[model samples]
Target: MKLKLYADRMSQPVRAVIIFCKKNGIDFEEIRVDIAKRQNLTPEYAEINPMKQLPAIVDGRFKLFESHAILVYLASSFPGVADHWYPADVFKRSKIHSVLDWHHSNLRRGPTTIVRNTVLAPVLGRPLNPEAAAEGEKFLSASLSKIESVWLKGNGRFLLGGNQPSIADLSLVCDIMQLELLGETERNRLLGPYKEVQQWIENTRNATNPHFDEVHKILMKAKEKLQNPRMKGATNEGGGSDMKRTLHSRI
Candidate 1:
């Protein structure tokens, strides 16, 4: 049997995996597990992935979860993928490892929290969580600052001073893309200070063109919904069906 990928395009991590597979010419069946519909919460899906997250995979009898782990496994297990993605060099690969590890709490948490509170909560029939939003902003600011001062400080086309894109680049950039859901003022507040980070976003896009753009179409479409006044009003409602309806269509 071919590899099975349980994913949803609405998710950034899922998009990273899909983009990687497409970019590397890896053949696998793509399975959509819609989170907005709570499909992943089903009992059957739990058997496939106990954690019940999007972007799980079953390769033969082997099962893997977590986007970073999947990326490394694909890079290492596949025969012809580029070395820069999961480098063979001890130091370079170690740097990639370090970045990925740092990502879960720092880079990943920031946007997830912000988006969930600012946009997702309202759409889910819940009020915006101000405390959580403030916390997310604090962490997000720090993460971006580190990316500018530490990660991108190296003179390379991508992160870790490499000339080619790595999984880390795709992962963090996708996380940063969440800012698109914010209004212009808030988006600028979050992303404007990081000039190098912005440049890196473009470079990663250039490196992973067409595929990157293709995978992110869902997000691009959702960004448009944020501009609509009805959507904003729905979020303000404590538990509005319109908000759920909008999220279901877009998310």
Candidate 2:
């Protein structure tokens, strides 16, 4: 049986999986799970992924969640996929593993917290938390400094001192990309000093190509909507459907 991917493109990890599948030409069914609609909370999706996360997979009788694990599984299971993505070299693979493990607590925290508080909370009728967003920016700034000074220090164009991109590169870049949803001032404040990191993001996008653009189109669309004048007074109670429509599906 072909692999089955349950995903919603609005999610960073889900976008990583989508881009990986397209880049490697992996055959899989794309099942859309709209998180804004509470679709992932349904009993049907629970059976596939007990965690009820956005990006889960079914390979025959086996079930798996967690984006990093899924990326590794795809690389190992598919013989046709390029080797550089999840290298067989012991040392290189070890570096990739290290990055993936470090990502959850460090790199992932900033955007998830910032975006949740700045964007989603207001949209969901929750009280806005400026303090939480401020804290997220602090973490985000530190994470970017590490990426610029340490992770990308090597001569290779990509992470892990490799000529080609790896899952580590994809995972972190997607997380950072979430910042694009912020308004210009806030986005610049958070990302402006990370020139190396910004360039790396472009490199990753170029490497992932048409697929990256396609998967990320929703984010761009949402960003545009946020800039609209009419959106100024939009409230969670009154504009819930509009927010749902803007964020729910691929276009």
> Against the unseen true structure, what C-alpha lDDT does each candidate score?
0.84, 0.84
Candidate 2 lDDT by residue in tens digits, 1-251 = 99999988889999999999999999999988888678888999999998988799999999999999999999999868898899999988999999888788788989878987886665556788999988988889888898878888988778766678999999999999888888688788788888888889999999999999999988876776665637634754246466645553422
What is the lDDT, from 0 to 100, of the residue 233 in candidate 1? 51
Q: Against the true structure, candidate 2 has what lDDT?
A: 0.84
Poorest lDDT segment (10 consecutive residues) of candidate 2: 242-251
- Candidate 2 segments whose C-alpha is farther than 4 A from its true place: 229-241, 248-251
Q: What are the TM-scores, per candidate, against the unseen true structure?
A: 0.91, 0.92
In the range 53-99, model 1's lDDT, one tens digit per residue, is 87899999999999999999999998789998999999989999899
Work out candidate 2's RMSD over C-alphas. 3.2
**Candidate 1, number of clashes:** 0
lDDT of 2 at 127: 83
Candidate 1: which stretches are off by over 4 Å?
230-243, 246-251
